[model samples]
Target: MLGIVLPAIITAFSLLILDWLLPGITIDTVTASVLAAVSIGIVNGVVKPIIQLLSLPLTFVTFGLFSLLVNGFCLWLSSAFVPGFEVRGLVGFLVGPIALSFLSTTFGHYLLEGRTPASLPEA
Candidate 1:
């Protein structure tokens, strides 16, 4: 449970980056951004798998490219739940989520590399 916290926080920061990087996406407040991140996590954890399973045939037909739409759908669904967070148009629907994932992973990697339990204990 505690382990999940860092990734979620990282994701919120990544969303803030996305807000800066993409014009089609809007996150008005930090609190809204965090809520949007949590909403995205919930959608990914609870809804996306089911959608993936249902869309498996389409995914197979498209050689997995269709998974991008699925990912976009998840991000769109997440935005709907958080006030002041909006993902609009094709770029927001398609590219925003991919960027967010990349930013979150990169940030998480660098952050984790800098702070291990051993390093923390020393500091």
Candidate 2:
């Protein structure tokens, strides 16, 4: 439960940050941000695998980098369904996913996973 819920909340926070930093991403309200975050998680879990299977050839050709485009498309699709959340233009589609990925990874590693400087052994 914590594993699933925590990541979703973290993703919401990342979305909020992205909304603040990027003009292309708009999250109108707190409720919308939460909805959008859940939507993205659903899309990633349900839709992404199907898309990946279909795009396997392209993914292979691109050395797996094409997965990023798939991820961006999922984020864009979630925005379309959420009224107050909007990702505008091609730049938004591209940057939104990348920024979300970066923030989510950082949050998961350092925050959610409970890794801290004090926990590390000194060399």
Candidate 3:
């Protein structure tokens, strides 16, 4: 389906972009990037919400800044399951996810602009 495939491709492409920009982030091959992308999506979808729920108090105490740790943990955990994809150090842990988020948003917006329902003509 376009819905699933599009986001996965975007995530993979965003990982490749991060690999290029961040020294601490290394994706050995295109396959690794794609695998990592799927892994990240799965982790974010399944694990992130539980972690977020558990960390609700901290998240509130930190004024939502605690989400950085949750996001970074999800990224790191996903990397552990995928070979040839490595996120190293604090920069990779924190900044990699941050950069990935930004790149994914920007790329997805431009690439998916015309595909959105708002662009469809009224029936």
Please report the candidate that would top TM-score against the real structure.
3
What's the TM-score of each model vs. the native? Answer: 0.90, 0.86, 0.92
- Model 1: CA > 4 A from native: 114-123
Candidate topping lDDT = 3
Write one digit per residue (lDDT tens) for candidate 2, span 26-88: 999988999999999999999999999999999999999999889889999999899999998
| Candidate 3 deviant stretches above 4 angstroms | 117-123
Checking candidate 3 for backbone clashes, the offending pairs are none
Q: Is candidate 2 or candidate 3 better by lDDT?
A: 3
What tens digits encode model 3's per-residue C-alpha lDDT throughout 1-123? Answer: 567767889999999989999988999999999999999999999999999999999999999999999999999999999999999999899999999999988998898885774554444
Pairs of residues clashing in candidate 1: none
lDDT of each: 0.90, 0.88, 0.91
Residue-pair clashes per prediction, in order, are 0, 0, 0
lDDT of 1 at 2: 39
Per lDDT, what order, best first?
Answer: 3, 1, 2
Q: Model 1: how far is 7 from its true place, Å?
A: 0.8
